[model samples]
Structure formats: structure tokens, C-alpha cells
Target chain A: MLTIDSLTKRYGRGAPAVDDVSFTCAPGTITGFLGPNGAGKSTTLRMLTGLTPPTSGSATVLGLRYPDLPNPGRVVGVMLDASAQHAGRTGRETLRLAASLVGVPAARADDMLERVGLAGAERRRVRGYSLGMRQRLGIATALLGDPLALVLDEPANGLDPEGIRWMRELLREFAAGGGTVLLSSHLLHEVEATVDRLVVIGAGRVVAQGALADLLAGSGVVVRATEPDRLAAALRAAGVTAAPTGDGALRVDADAETVGRAALAAGAVLTELRAADGGRLEDLFFSLTGAAGSGAPARTEVAA
Target chain B: MTATTVATTGDGTSRALPEVPRIPFSRIVSVELRKSLDTRAGTLLVAAAVLLTLAPVGWQLTHLTDGVPDFDLWVSSARGGVALFLPVIGILAMTSEWTQRTALTTFTLVSRRGRVLAAKLAAAVLVGVAVMAFVLAVAAAALLVASGLEGTTPVWGDVGSVVGGSLVASALNVTMGAAFGAAIAQSAAAITMFLVAPTLWQVVGTALLGDDAQWLDVFQAFARLSSFELAGHDAQVVTSVLAWVGLPLAFGWVRALRRNVS
Candidate 1:
């Protein structure tokens, strides 16, 4: 388990980069750390890995601070930057060196290279490798010690679709084996597809966090009828929050059954009625953070 | 940090994952030594140093009309040429991490940043020793050739100072280069400062203190140290080392230990 308690990092008197943030990544779960660019995701990862000191609070891996952990590489694997590799060494040599540092046998280097699909390119210098290849090598380096927990920042940025699928499955298998994973990304769809839990941060603070299913099971319904505004007003009279989704649809904070009863009692003919999508994590993300383009769920738009 | 606690399976049998040992410092040093010579740039710099050492001896041989050069003279000349180029190899060892952006990977694996720096230093000192030995062998061969042409016995007098002085000079030069490399993490900036700072300081000191007080100049003081002549100016040599090597090394060590890898 990884516990981050009220962690904060401030750069020279400027506002905090990561401010009073706290969360836990339980074992056997893939937690997606979602945020926009400069959202303190990398800074937090850096602090956790002991690459940068935290201004206040602490981040511990397996109940111990990163630097204090014995053989930390075997306990917590981190890949903050995939391209942060020595360009002079061959791909195979890089893995071998990492294996040596982590106290793993040299044979693991060849095994990891083939596993990451870099077997043929093992003799090539890293300077000659493409971005996607470098990402694969970075993954290989992180897994060199078979760590119990992994922390990666934007590991899928340079991967192709097939590579991304492979990575998704790899992390899934890792978590299945009781390993903890905290993957940070700005790519909403990829995180949505891979994570069992979500921690959405914005402007250095967490705006929302919970299990994927629990967070997505929204208590709302989408209603469409002959007169949208009239139906919306009737739902408001019934102590239900109703707003237009800008696609000729009304999103009401009431179950579909209650919404149907409200429309019927108000004598409003309904053309369409359905439960609000519990999978609109993106919309929920933007709404919670007040990000640009979130524009309160009041505008009419096509329902997904 | 492992536990002996066992987990029960579905059939109530207990199993545990085997524990692995942590890596030793010797392994870190070996990896660093390998890395020092693994780079294309490092290999080329070493080859260039060797060729440069040979070029001077070749010139000395062709120009040997004055009763053949002394064996000591040949050794000193060869050491001079190798010394000029070997510092770059040492500087590359320290600055390569920042230039190639590998500090992240290196530090993440090791975690204790000081250990990595220590390994790099050890690697550089070994390179200096190896290069000094190679230069000594080639210089000795040239000395033998010159003595044979003149039909005179090879003079072994002063051989101890010649060998000892040259090794010390080469080691100091490489260490200074590493200090500069650490102080200025960028390769270009470190090399520029390493080559130009002492000369600029000498010029300023000469202008201020006049001809008689050249000993006050850092470059001159270092020359005295490299010469291995212990009869005079011991104080000046100490001061020069503090100014040139100690100060910059302190700056670099603090930065390396404190700076964020990103």
C-alpha cells in the first residue's frame, strides 16, 4: 500500500505545486491519477520517488519513506520520464545495468527485452530508438526488480494502439498479482479503460476520488419531452434539480421512475426518458474542476 | 525488509516468496566502470589521448639530432601530451548524466545519490591510473629507441620522480576536470570553464601582482604541484588546490545532492 498524507510542494515562495493532497493506493487496485497538464501529477510522483523533496507532509511506500525503504527499487518502481535514459548504452545493456543495480540476475535483462518486444533491437543504442521503443525500454527498466508497487507518469503518451493495449493488460495482470499501481495521465479514455479507481486532481488539489463504479453511479436521469422547460419547471417544483444538457434534453437529479411520475403529474408528455449515463466520467471531471468547456450541464447537447 | 509470515492457500497450506539480497557497492562501481568506457564519445576521447601521446614522441624522435633525447625528457614530454587530453575523459564521466538526461534512471535505481557520485569518482580515478600506466609504457619504449640510436646506456636516474610526478599530475588533472564537471553539469559549460578559468585567473593575477609574484597565480601554483618539486612553495600549492579543486567540488557535490532530477 502507498499512503500520501497531506503532501505539499512549493517552489520558492510561489503557490504550492501540490497542496495538502492526500490519498491512498490500496494493494490489488489500479488507481488512475487524473489531472490536466501542470496539475501536480509529475511533482507528486517525483516526491514519492524521492527525486524531489516535499515541502510539507510525507509519501510512504509500503509503510516506509521512499529513501528509508531497503532496496527501494524492489519495493516501488517508478518511471517519471520514459526518455530519461542513457543514449550511449544499448537497449540490452541499459536493462542489464538496471538489473545489476536492483540486485536482479543478468538473465532477466534478455527476458524483459523480449517481453517488452525489444528483443530484436536489444543491440541498438538508445539514441537510435524511437519514442515508443524508449517507452517500452522504460517499462522494462521499471520491472527489472519485480517491485510490489509501480508509479508511472504518462507511460502511454508515446505508445501505439497495440502497445497501449499490451500495457493495459500488463498493469491489469500486475494488479491481479496483488501489486499496487498509481498511474497518472491526462488521457481520459485510457484511464477510464484501465483503472479500477479514480483520483481526479486539479490546480494542486483533489476535486474528486472514489472507486470507478461508485463515482460513476450518478443519481440523475435524462428527460426529454414535448416542452423541455415546462418539464424542467415541474421537476424543480418537486424538489428535484433539473438542468438542460444543451441537446434538447433535461438532466434531473432524480431516478428515472421519479422523473416519469413528475412529468406525468405535470401533464407534460414525455418523448424520451432514460437514466443518466454512469460512464460520463469526463463530464463529471470537468464539472467538478470547473475546467474550461465544462460549462454547467445546462446547455442542450446530444445525449451519449 | 522482508517478513517470514506465510499465507494460507485454499487447502490451508502456507507458501512464501523467496527474499532477494540488496546490491553491493562493488556492483555499483563495476557498472560505473563499464559505463565510463561504454560510450562512443568516451572511447574516442581515450583513443585521441593515446594518439596525441604518440604524436609528440614521434616528433621528438624525428627531431633528435642533439645526441638523442634523455630518457627522462621523453617520459616528461609524453606525459605532457596525455595530460592535456585525459581531463576531457574525466569530465565526460560526470557530465554525461546531465547531457544525456540519464540521471533520472540512474538515481531511481540507486536512490542514494551519493553512492552513484562515489562510483563515478572511483571510475574516473581508475581511468586516470590506467591511462598513466599506458603513457609510461609508451614513453619507456621511446626512451629505449633513443638510447639505442645514440649507442649510450639508458639512464635510469630520476626515473622514480618522472614516473611518480607524471602519475600524480594526470590524477590531479582528471580529478579537477571531474570537479568542474560536477560544478557545471552541462558538458559544454563544464568543459569551457575547466579549460578557460585558470588561464583567465592567471592573467588577472599577473596583472595585479606583477612578474615577481607569479606564484600567486593559481595556474602557476598548480604547475609547481604537478612538477612534484617539494623544495619550495608548498603553501602556494595548498592554496591553489583549495581554490581550484576543493571549492568547485564542494559546489558540484551540493548541487548534485540537492537538485531535482527533473
Candidate 2:
């Protein structure tokens, strides 16, 4: 299990980059740490991996701080930056060095190179590698110790669609085998597809987090109508709070059935009304992050 | 620092897993040694050192104007060329982690940053010793040429101090370079400091303290490192070495160990 309690990091006198955040990532689950630019997702991951020290509070993997754990690489493998490998070394040499550092047999380097689909590029220097190749090499280095847990930051950043799909399956299999994973990414679709749970951060605070299904289910309905203002007022009259999405839509904290009946009683013409499916996670994300303005509704209309 | 005890799953169930033993220091050193030689920069730096050392040997043997050059002098001259450039190799080894931005990968693999740094230092020391040996071999070849030119047999009696002093001096230079590299953490910046800062300090000391500056000059102290027979300079040598090497190394070691990997 990964336990983070009130973890915070403040640079100089500025606001905390990661502020008083707390969450748990249990075994047998892939927790997607989602956030936008400057939302402190990287800071949090850095704290967890002992790359950056917290100003206050603590983050631990398996009940111990990263540095405190004996053989931390064997317990929690981390890939904070995919380009952090030495450019002068070959792909195989990079993994071989990692294996040696972790006390794994050198043969593990070849195995991981094949595993990450870089077998043919094993002898190439990282300086000549494409960004995607570097990501694969980074992943190979992470798995060199056959760690029990993984903490990856933007593991899908440089991957192509097929590579991303492969990574998702690989992480899923790792978790299914009783490993713990905390993956952070700004790509919403990637997180939605890969993670079992979601921990969303906005402005350095966790705005929402829980099992993916539960968070989506709790998001209620995304309703649209010709007279959005009137429909919103009627939902208010029905004791359901509706937040305007700045388009021809209102998001209510009630089921679609309840919203439909309220709209019917108010004599409002319904153009669209449904439990948000693909847009559900994105909707919940914007709402929690306080971005339910012009952007969310515009995106929803485009998707619709 | 050596081992972790979490053998069970996060759900409190123990699964059949392969046992991973703690990594020994020897393995870490071996990897560090391999890394020093594997990189282009490292390989080039060593190649350059060897070429530079041989250049001086070749010049002396071809010229042969000083009549059968003293074997000790011939070796010392060659060692001088090696010592001049060998420290750069050491600096590259120490600063490569930061220069390549591989500290995150390195520390993550070995959580004990101290051990990794220790391994790097050990690898550098090994390189230093090897460089000294290479210079000595070139000097031995130069001695044969000198003997051929002068029709005098080469004496092996003076080989000990020349070899011993050169090893100690070259190794010390490597360590000093590494200490500066660790403190600065950037290759260009550390190399600049290693090469220029001491010379600047020497000049400033001479201007400000006059004759008293000799007592604190790192170069003056290094000049006496191999020749303790100089007498009365022992204390100056210790103080100069401590000031130049020990202080920065201690500070850099702590910073490297504690600073955030990011």
C-alpha cells in the first residue's frame, strides 16, 4: 500500500507546489493520479519516490518512507522522468547498469529489453533514440529489479497509440498479479483507460479521488435543453442543485430520470439528456477542478 | 540501507516470489567501473590522457639532448603529463550523474546514494592507479631509448620513488577533481573550478598574504607530496591538502546524499 498523509512542498515563500495532500493506493489496483499543468502531480510523485523532500507530512510505500525501505528499488520501482537515462550509454547498457546496481543478474537486462519491445534497439545509444524509445528504455530500467510496486509519472507521454495500449495492458497485468501502481498523467483518456481508481488534483490540492466507477456514478446527469436557464431553475425548484456548463447544458447532482421529470414539469424542451458515458470522467474532472465554465460545455458539445 | 523486508503483497498475503538478496559493494563498484569506461566522454578522456603522456615521452626520447636522461627524471616528466589531464577523467566520472540527469535513475536503483558515490570514487581510484602504471611503462620505454643513445646501461635503482610518487600524486589529483565535481554537480562548472579556481586562489594569496601564502598554497603542498624528504613542509602539505580536498569533498558528499534527486 502507498500512504501519503498531508504531504506538502513549498518552494521558497511561494505557495505549496503540493499542498497537504493525502491518499492511499492499495494493492491489486492501478491508481491514476490525474492533474493539469502545474497541478503538483509531479511534485507528489517526486515526494513519494524520495526525489524531492516534503516540507511537511510524509509519503510512504508499504508503510515506510522510500529512503527508509531496505532495497527500495526492489520494493518500489519509479520512473519520474523517462529521459533521465544516460544518453551516452546504449539501451542494453543502461538496463545492465540498473540490474547491477539492484543486484539482479545481468541477463535481466536482455529480458527487459525484449519485454519492453526494444530488443532490436538494445545496442543503440540513447542519444540516437526517439522519445518513444527512451520511454521504453526507462520502463525497462524500472522493471530491472522486478519491483513489487511502481510509481510512474507520465509513463504514456511519448508513446504512440499502440505503445500506450501495450503499456496499459502491462500495468494491468502487474496489478492483477498483486502489485501496487500509482501512475500520474495529464492525459484524461489514457488514465480513464488504464486506471481502476482516479486521484485528481487541481491547484496543488486533491479535488477528487476514489474508485473510477464510484466517482463517475456519483457525478449524476449531464442535461441539455433549449431553455437551459429555465431547466436549471426547475431543477433548483425540485431541490436538485444544477451547475451551469456555460453552453446549452446544466449538470445536476441527480439522476437523469429525476432531471427528465423535473424538465417535463417545467415544460422545457429537452434537446439532450443522458447519463454522461465517455464524457462522465471528463465532466467530473472539470467540475471538481472548477473548470466547468466555457471549456467543459464546449468540449461536451463537440463530443456530442 | 541494504535490504527491505516487505515480502508479502500489500493485502497482507504472502505469495511465492523469487528472493532478491542485498547488493554487495563489490557489484556496485564493478558497475561504476564499467560505466566509467563505457561512455564516449570517459573513453575519450582516458585516451587523451594516454596520448598526452606518450607525447612527452616521445619528445624526450627523440630529442635525447640531455645525455642519457636520468630514468627517474624521464618517468617524472611523463607522469607530469598524465597527472595534468587524468583529473578531468575523474571529474567526468563524478559529475556524469548530474550532467546526464541520471541521478533519478541511479538513486532509485540504489537508494543508498552514499554507496553509489563510494563506488564511483573507488572506480576513479582504480583508473588513477592504472593511468600511473601506463605512464610508467611509457617512461620505461623512453629509458631504453635514452640508454641506446648514450651507450649507458639503465639503472633500476631509482624506479621506486618515481613510480611511488607519481601514483600518489596522480591519484591525489583524481580525488581532488572528484571532490570538486561532487561539490559543483555540473561538468563544465566543476571543471572550470577544478582548473582555474586554485590558480586564482594562489595568485590572491600571494598578493594578500605575501610570503605567508606559501603555507596555504595547494600546488606548493602538492609539489611536496611525493618528496617528504624536503623537510619542514610536512605541516604545510597536510593543511593545504585538507583545505583543497577534504573540505569540499565533505560538503559535496553530504549534499549529494541529501539533496533532492529532482
Candidate 3:
């Protein structure tokens, strides 16, 4: 298990980049680190990997502080800043060098290259590799030691659709094999589809942390109906809230079955009746951070 | 029987998983050396050092035959070759990490930053020793050919000191280069400073201090250390070695260990 305890990092007394952020990711799970630009996702990852020292607090991997660990490369496979690679080295050579550093056999490099689907292009220099290819090479390098824990910062940044699919599957497979995986990404939709648990940060502090299901439990679903006034009345009677959407339809925050039944009971012709995908998760994110559209809702820290 | 067998097999398969081997430090150093050696620039630096050392010795062999055949002559000739080429080799070694972006891969594998620096320094010293040996061998061969023409015996003691001094000087130069690269953390700037700093120090010292200016020149100090000549002067050879080599290296180490890798 990876435990980050009260991790606080401040740059020159500026606002803490990562403030009192605490979370645990156990083996057999993929934890998605969600945050906006400049939200300290990268900084937090750097501190965890011991690339940068935290102003205060600590992160332990497998119950040992990063510096105290006997063999760090064997325990934690980190791929922070995917662009941190030599342009002159070939994809295969890069992994080979990394494996050698971690004291793994050279043959493992070829295996990892094939695993990341870069087998064909392993001989080609990294400078010639596309952004997606570089990302794959980075992943291969990370897996050279067959680490127990994986920490990736924006691993999906430059990936195409097919590459993203492969990455999602790869991460899931890694997690399934009883390894801890913590990935940070700006793609909320992808995170929603891939991760089981999430730690969402905003303006440097973790605003939400739990299983995706638990966080979305009280976050009511959106229901759209044609007969606006009648649907609103029915939703109120069913102890649900409804607001008129831009398209002149009542958007009710209730389950689809209840809203459909209420529309049927009200004898209102339902042109469209469906629950939206929990208000786009992004909207919930904005609302949680008080960073919604102009004149955002008054800042209220949501108690997790 | 088939149903019972399948149930038992499924239950047994879920018992446990085998362990994976852990990587060791020796492998890390070996890999670092391999990657450093594979580069085109690395090959060129070694080739240049070899050629430069042999070319001058080869020319000297073809010409002069009047002086006594001595290892001091060979040592001096080899030192001349090293004085010209080793600094360039040193610059290449230090800047290659940054220019290639290999620093990222290097640091990631050996996350303890200090170890990575240590490994690079060790590799550089080994290379410096090898290059010095090559220069000495080539110079000896050239002198033997000259001695055959002149029918004279060669002095081995002077040859040994020359080779030893060249090796020590080359090692110091390489270490200085690594330290400079670490402190500056930029290839262009580090290379430029490595090339120009000593010359600038020499010129400034000569203009200001007159005959005693040698004491102020960094290059002169380094040369004095290599020649073991500092008794007559106020500054000790030990002090010169420490100032030129030790101070810069310590500063570089601090910068490398503390600076955030960009």
C-alpha cells in the first residue's frame, strides 16, 4: 500500500502547492488523481517519487519512506513528465539502460518493449518517435524493474484514441496483477471510465477522495422531460428537484425510473425522458471547487 | 471425475504468486557505462584523444634525433597532447548528459541523484585513465622508433612520471568538467566556461601581476600541480590542486544534489 500523510509543499511561502493531502492506494486498485491546470498534481507526484523534497509531510511506499527504501526502483515505477528522455537513445536502449540501473536483466527490456507494443519501433531513436510512441517508451522504461507500485503523471497526455485504449487496458492489467497504480490525468471522462477510486484536487488541496460511487452518491442525477411544468410538479411530488433546461424541458434531479413513472402518472406526453451522466463530473468538479462559470457559487469546502 | 478435477484445479491455482528478482547497483553502473559508450559523441571524444596523441608523437619521431633518448621527452610530448585534447574530452563528457536529455533517464534509474553523479564521475575517471595509458603507449612506440634510428637507449623513469602526471592531470580535468556541468546545468554555458575561463584568468593575471602572474593563473596552477613544481612559489601544489579541482567539484555536487531537475 502507498500512504501519503499530510503532504504539504509550499514554494517560497506562496500558497501550498499540495496542502495536508492524505490518501492511501492499496494493491489491486487504480487511483485516479484529478485536478485542474496548476492544481499541484505534478508537484505531488514529484514529492512522492522523491524527485523534489516536500516543504513538510511525507509519502511512504510499501511502508517505507522513499529515501529509506533499500531498492526504490524495484518498488516504485514512476513515469513523471513523460518528456524526460534522451532524444538520441533508441526506445529499446532507453529501457535497457533503465533495467541495468535497477539491476534487472537486459532481456526484460525487450519484454517490456513488446508489452507496450513498441517492439517494431524499438530500434528507432526516441527523437524520431511520435508523442504517442514516446509515451509508450516511457511506460516501457517504468516497467523495466517490474515494480510493485506505479505512479504516472499525465500518461495519457499525448496518446491517440487507440493508444489511450491500450494504455487503459495496460494500467488495468497492471492493477489486476496486484500492483498499486496511481495515475494523474486532466481527462475526466477517461478517469471516470478507468479508475475505481479518485482523489480530486483544486487550487492545491484535495477537495474529494473516495470510491467514485460514494462521491457520486449524493450528487443527484439529471433528468430531462418534454412537458416542463407538469414534469416539475411531478418531480416535486416525488421529493425530487427539477429545473428548466435551455431547450425548454424540465431537467429533474432524480432516477430515470421515478421520473418516467411520474411523467406517466401525470399524463404528460414525454418527448424525451433520460437521466444525464451525473452532470458531466466536470460540472460537479467545478461546483466542488467553487470555480463554476462567472459569479460562481460562494466558496464552500465540501465535507468529504 | 472431470467436474471434480476441474474444481480442484481452480481452487489450487488461487493459492499464491512467485517472487520477482530485485535489481542491484552493479548493474546500474554497467548500464550507465554502456549507454555513455554507445553514443556517437562518446566514440568521437575517445578517437580524437587517441589520434591527437599519436599524430604529434608520430611527427616528433620522423624529425628530431640529436637529444638524449629520455622518458622526460616522451612525458613532455604526451603532456602537450593531453594539454590540448583532454579539456575538450572533459567538456564533451560533462555536457553530453544535458545535450542528450539522458540525465532524465539516468536520474530516474538512480533516483538518489548523488549516486548517479558518483557513477558518472567514476566512469569519467576510468576513461581518463584509459586515454592516458593509450597516449603513453603511443608516445613510447614513437620514441622507440626514434631511438632505433638514433641508436640510443630510452629513460624509463621519466617515461613513467610523464605518463603518471598526464593521467592525473586528465583525471582532474575530467572531474572539473563534471563539476562545472553540474553547477551550470547547461551544456552550452558549461562548455564555454570550461574552454574560456582558464585563458581569461591567465590573461588577466599576466597583465596585472607581471612576473609573479603565474601564481594568479588557474591554468598555470593546474600545470604546476601536474609538474610537481610549487616549492619556490608561495602557493603550494597541494593548494593549487585543491583550489582548481576540489572547490569547483564541491560546488557542483551541492548544486546537483539541491537543484530541481527541470
Q: Report the number of the highest-lDDT candidate.
A: 2
DockQ ranking of the models = 2, 1, 3
TM-score of chain B of each: 0.87, 0.90, 0.78
Pairs with backbone N, CA or C atoms under 3 Å apart (clashes), candidate 3: A101-B28
Better TM-score candidate (1, 3):
1
The docking category that best describes candidate 2 is: acceptable
Models sorted by lDDT, best on top: 2, 1, 3
* Per-residue accuracy of model 2 over A1-304 as CA lDDT, tens digit each: 7889999999899667887888888767899998776788999998888878899999977677887766777878789899888889999888888887787888988999999999999999999999889988888887777777889989998899999999999999889877888999886887788898888787778777788877666667788899888888899899998887777678778888899899899999899887756466675565645652123222111100
Q: What is the interface RMSD of each candidate, in Å?
A: 4.7, 4.5, 6.7
**Residue A187 shift from truth in candidate 2, angstroms:** 2.1
Worst 10 residues of 3 chain A by lDDT: A292-301
lDDT of 2 by residue, B193-236 (tens): 99898899899999999978877788778768865454787777
TM-score of each: 0.89, 0.88, 0.87
Worst 10 residues of 3 chain B by lDDT: B1-10
Candidate 3's docking class is acceptable
True contacts kept of 3: 0.35
Residue B227 CA displacement from its true place in model 3, Å: 2.9
Docking quality (DockQ) of candidate 2: 0.47
